[model samples]
Target: MVELLAGLSENCVRLLDVAAAGVLLSDGRGVLRLVAASSERTRLLELFQLQRDEGPCLDCFRTGTPVLVPELAATADRWPAFCAAADGVGFRSVHAVPMRLQTTVLGTLGLFGSQVGSLDRSDLDLGQALAHVASVAVVNERAAADSATVNAQLQHALTSRVVLEQAKGVIAHVGDLTVEDAFRVMRRYARDHGRRLGEVAGDVVERRLAGRDLLEHARSVDLLPEE
Candidate 1:
């Protein structure tokens, strides 16, 4: 599986205008860890984005959808920290393709380009194929990792879901709103604050910040309503 992913990354670098390529695998609880990269630069960049909790990769992973940013400089308003950091690294554009099987999303494949341009249809199609391959690689890796405890898979999945639900409640309470409204508020906060919504939600649930304090902080940051 590792060799396959390495081959795919090499193919992506050769076939596309991307300077760097990477695959990220999500643990199903909003945590995406790097699985593979075409080069050291790609790995470093991905880790940087994950640590900062901002970037197209995280967006794609969260939405379970592709994200194509044609011009990093022009999209500064949309992703302030990500744009600045990517530009500093000489990346002018980024594209992220989600790796999904049916309704289950496994991860994301991200491409970084040093030039600015919209991805053509062919590029999009190729990216999707790569994402599919990445998904297969992730599943294989997971199977290998859990080979000793096959029966625990379902339990782990359930626990992850429970944690995610608790995190959602934390967001709702912190924002002083309904669940759906809280999600919207959290998403908006993520966009404006240059952080991932899941990370913020986790912090809320872990009691790192009080619910009322979160509400007040959100208001101060222009993230949510005062009430």
Candidate 2:
């Protein structure tokens, strides 16, 4: 099953105008972890995005909708840090398509373009088709192993736990807190930062620039009211 999914992902990398491609599986709380990428560079890109908690892919996964960003330069303000970093690396555009089955969202398939221009209708259609295939492959794999509901829940839980543990470690190191306290700190940080908790957690795990600096910045920014 894993082999089949890997093949599907590889095919996606070849079939699109994207310079990089990745497949992520959702853990049911709006977090997608990288399952595969077309190449090492693509995987690194996905990891960077996940750790930063910003990017079209994260947006699509959260909204269960597709995101097409044609110009990273002109729209830098929309995702200030993300745009800067992505542009620095020569990725000027991005497209993210949600991988979903019915109401169940499996994850997202993300594409990166090194130039700026909205994807034409044909490209959009192809992106959507690829996303659908990836979603189906994930669902079918789970269903074949057991009842759909059980398998789905199990997968989601396992993925979420892995992400959570990694986030806890990040928070612990950065905030100088224990694991439990780190979780609390992260929850608080997410709420105050106006971001999803799991997304923040993923960022911490990935050690993105933002997440890596979050604790020091949090200290400087005054997280609580002064006495």
Report the Cα RMSD per candidate: 14.7, 13.6
Q: Please provide, for model 1 over 1-227, each residue's C-alpha lDDT reduced to its tens digit, 9 standing for 90 to 100.
A: 43345456668889977888887766545477765577666767888888888899999989988999988898788778878878888889999999876666666889889899877889879989877866554455456445333224323433433444476577676555766455445545556778754566566678775566556666787666556
Candidate 1 segments exceeding 4 Å error:
140-227
What local distance difference test score does each model get?
Answer: 0.70, 0.69
Candidate 2 backbone collisions, by pair: none
Candidate number achieving the greatest lDDT relative to the actual structure? 1
Q: Would you give me the overall lDDT of model 2?
A: 0.69
Structural similarity to truth (TM-score) of each candidate: 0.60, 0.61
**Which stretch of 10 consecutive residues in model 2 shows the poorest summed lDDT?**
218-227
Tens digits of per-residue lDDT for model 2, 1-227: 33334455577657777776777776544466776566555666777888888888888888889988888788777778778877777788888888877766677888778778888778778878877876675666446344456356537544654686687777677556666556556666776779766677677777663553556545655752222
